[model samples]
Target: MKFQDYKVTDINLADWGQKEINIAETEMPGLMALRKEYSSSQPLKGANIVGCLHMTIQTAVLIETLIALGASVRWSSCNIFSTQDHAAAAIASKNIPVFAWKGETEEEYNWCIEKTLSGSDTWAPNLMIDDGGDLTKIVHEKYPGLL
Candidate 1:
């Protein structure tokens, strides 16, 4: 996804968030190993993934790992108040379209989920990873064609 399409709280925090992601990569050996094992095969090649979860440092690592395995991804935070802005920034910096921020209103939260579902004409997520089921609910209600 284009970097400009992302709607994160801050782009400036990317450096800090990237550092945290780097640290997390070291701590998450299993995911890292999976990346190393499958990157060449690209098992998820051409797959589009939409993820709704807490926007945290650990999640950043997971997002990057997904990319490494050859999936295109769009992400959103499950809870408006649970997003780590820096983590959002970092993921966005990598050109993974993200629609989330801290303190989002109800309307904003729904908007974010919509964005994740219909982010790009070239990429419509075939796989969903949702935490609180909001993403699933919205997709079912508004974009049943996807199911």
Candidate 2:
């Protein structure tokens, strides 16, 4: 609930986080299978996926699936209260780059979204997946090339 830097390599914590992801997978059978298939196909190779969604188990699975599909993903929470602490832990465990947390103030929330939107030229997100259109608007206004 507080601000702290957690690296994905924190083995003990990451394992617990990974377990959370596994649990999420159980409830997301279709996405799990899709991730397996996409991992093999790599359809989104070289693509960056910037997502603005609730940081929950469901979202964690989707993030993993996107990586498995060969995407470089940057994820942030759509709502301050919607972050699943354990889900974020699990994602951080996998060493996935994520920025968002529960109980974020408006300033912190906007800062997270801004940070996620920053990217290298080619690696900048070509596709924006958002629940409320925040990411698209940010990119369109700040980094028009990504649009």
Candidate 3:
């Protein structure tokens, strides 16, 4: 999906979430080291990744690391209630596509998952990072051709 098509609860909270992400970056030494080590080599270069996880400050750090490693990414929350709006906003502010919000209904949750899976042929995700099996299950059920 295009970045403009991303569905987030609020874009206004980006600045606040960005501050939290900055703090989280400082606490995540291992991921930071990976960014430093692989940024030049770009091991994940040309990879497209879809991530389904809790959209929290910590997850933001992980997402940023993936970008640093040269992967393009789209993200959605694994749990409807686990999303942190500010964190989603922060990630989205960087032009990364994010499809999630706190307190989503079952329909909205599924919709977010679909958004993560939707993209142009050139932008389609080749890698998946799922904390829960929901995203995988959906892919298996609805887009078996991909599997």
Candidate 2 lDDT tens digits, 100-138: 778888898888888777654546677788988777777
Extract clashing residue pairs from model 2: 17-90
Q: Best to worst by TM-score, what's the order?
A: 1, 3, 2
lDDT of each: 0.90, 0.76, 0.91
Candidates in order: C-alpha RMSD to true structure: 1.4, 4.3, 1.7
**TM-score for each prediction?**
0.95, 0.84, 0.95
The 10-residue segment of model 2 with minimum total lDDT is 2-11
Q: TM-score of predicted model 1?
A: 0.95
- Which residue pairs in candidate 3 collide? 1-119
What global local distance difference test value does model 1 have?
0.90
Candidate 1 lDDT by residue in tens digits, 93-114? 9888899899999999989988
lDDT of 3 at 9: 91
lDDT of 3 at 104: 96
